[model samples]
Target: VEHKVLAGPFARAFPDAEFYATDRQYSFPLNLPDSFLGLPPWTRPLPESGAASDGSWGGEFDHEVLTVKPGPGSMYQDAAFFHGPSGTLLICDALFAATEEPPPILTEEPEYLRALLFHARDTPQEIVEDTPEARRRGWRRIVLLFNFFFPTSAAVADLGVGPLLNLRPYELGWGGWMPFRWKSREAEEEAFNKYSAGGSPTMLPIIQIILSRGGSGEDTLRWVEKVKRWSFKRIVPAHLDAPLAMGPEEFAETFAFIKKGRNEVRFCDQDVAFLRAAEEGPLSFSVYKSSLGVLRGQPCGP
Candidate 1:
């Protein structure tokens, strides 16, 4: 374990809080406390696949925390997965979310945190009286409730089978949830069809980054297949405002964009292939070079 940029603030904010890391390799400019290693609540490195049993986590966290290192290797070489108590399967940078919604804020921030709950789909409140005390109490209760239910402290997510991706602590205030600002509904729909099957264009870059690492087109498919086994009912990606709640039988449809991009890799321009090949090292010279290409603007060919 190593110290992150937020280590100081984190330590200052929660003096008693403990830290944890996955089995994957980690390093930083600063040294991390040894207590984080193999400690209680931290648990051991999670299994590479399958539903992690309750006892596996020592029951310290109340819910299962399954770890899924992307196939071939971890994403960004520093990614980790966890099955949150809310039934949400969390991913680090392996995936992202995007949509055409405005930043969910009420006026300037400070009020944003409290304002967000007023609009949240799952906000437990029904009648919020119009009063300073009522508003303050309501906001406090929501925050406390979310601390346990959604747990944004690590990464905010709802009680569903969804994932959120990398959001700098800074951008968290700027509404990191809405990653993409669509220029138009038509353009948005077009990109949606090509990138995320009208669900999340954020998956495009993730797939590209994966392919740049010599990722097999099947990575998303395989991961999705395994996720299906977990019987997750919803998807709350960190980037997108909309939670993906597809039918169990039609869940695979949500990832159609990734599958399409994977299949279309072979059709990518020669230059893009060469670039990816150069980045992926010499592992599969011809395979990766020829099979993994950019999806944003496909080249017709040389």
Candidate 2:
């Protein structure tokens, strides 16, 4: 995770600050243990219970734990805190949002620029001029690919099957690699438009897949209801554009696709074709209801 550079400094600077994490974070079932992932020795695990309220910070924060029914590819959970004074709902990754502007952090680096231009080109044979607009084009593609994993606008180009003349030159540093190709500029723009959705917040596309399958969505819905009870006017997720000027109603709307009788998906079906394929194949994430009517993700078999 390469978190030591940032996490080590922070942990040292404010050694007394309360540190909280879920138990699974330390003993992650699918990923590396916390010791290697960068958790300091002083860290403490948050309560395993779904909801844990702390009257600390002058009783201004309402901390709630949210968990999805675990599946083979499961292990999704987050702690949301409702700040009473600011009326802000703070979260880690339950929801996500990204503006069109290229994040300033990656703008000046040479490697980032090269990566951006990689997505800007139609194919290896075509040369794209390095420019501000070209860099912006690369960032847009990156955002789509990062969120959807393999948004509909791009597809892998099979170098093994293509003729030598069509292949890119070795001097380009990608002569033998299986690079992806864009379906069309229009397709890329269309997929991005759906993702932006007029700058509205949306849940992870994976959650949409679970709910679409056997997942009843009851567990997540209940968590949403719990969060809505707090008096928050703005929601701030850990990633992307923060402090969204939205209220409880707007925040609740993000999970609309998961509700029963809903036919629509969290994101466009075509846009998330790659995620869908991976879920059914290598990912194989699924959910079901238990005998007690509790919905959980189906665990992966050994």
Candidate 3:
């Protein structure tokens, strides 16, 4: 396999990160000999033991083994890679199933990897493929992860599904696979509506937004408006120190005010409630962009 160098732009954006080490013989933490800005513990390998069930021995084999743990501190920390204010690109070993693990790291070798990037509005097909720039840079197997947030309008595009499209086929080899499971949108909406009616702290809609497979820009704006309205009516008055509320239309006006870059909006009780809900899981509000050029969900603990 060709040893591809990390992209210069990526390096510049994340000065402290390092390239993946191919050697498995080396030990954890120590194995990452290259200098890196201190990363989280999950990035390092930890000693663990798992039982082997072959049924032939009739006994479980218990042994301490070295394993890699994925965490926010390592590759995930560089929010620029996942979600940027505009767009971003990120590279990682594997995108594991939500239930299997935290941030899944590839350990075995078929050299599996995931490349994520985002675009502004429409996919720049020409720029991605048949372009001297990318070809000269030695980019192969570019697969497009359709933006779940904006499907009809892709945040990034121009890549094909399989290797035939100058991209590699997604394979389940990195210890696990992408769990095709997603939360039910209708269920989430109902829960959100119920919460709003009763002024109960809930995170269903936020989770739905995060896990949504596709929607238009208008849809996103609409959803944001809904969030704002729910916050205003249900969470704000009940939670905020100083009660303030706005309808969906009024919240849009407030959003416009914030977007004007005039003044920062102060956190209200509703905001705190939303944040707390996000922290509790079943919700994602990460604004960081990934290499695929889309905002990635916040890291939810396992």
Q: Write the per-residue lDDT of candidate 2 for residues 2-68, one digit (tens) a residue.
A: 4223564677688889776666652223366676767788877776333444545677777777666
Candidate 1: tens digits of C-alpha lDDT, residues 1-302: 33234444554565465444444533332223434432343334444543443354444222222232333324223232334454444444434444333234422465664454343322232334444443333333333222122212211334342213423343224333322222333322332333333334234343444443344435555655655554455555444343555333454554565555543432223213433443456533323332444333343311
lDDT of 2 at 267: 50
Global CA lDDT of candidate 2, please? 0.63
Q: Candidate 1 — which pairs collide?
A: 162-235, 162-236, 163-237, 164-238
Tens digit of per-residue lDDT, candidate 3, span 4-90 = 123334455665654222222222233343233323322322222222222221232222222221222222100001112222212
Error of 2 at 70 (Å): 2.9
Q: How many clashes would you count in candidate 1? A: 4
Off by over 4 Å in 1: 1-4, 7-12, 15-18, 25-87, 105-206, 211-215, 218-220, 247-251, 254-290, 294-302
Clash count for each candidate, listed in order shown: 4, 4, 23
User: What are the Cα lDDT values of the candidates?
Assistant: 0.38, 0.63, 0.25
Off by over 4 Å in 3: 1-35, 38-180, 185-302
Pick by TM-score: 2 or 3, better one: 2
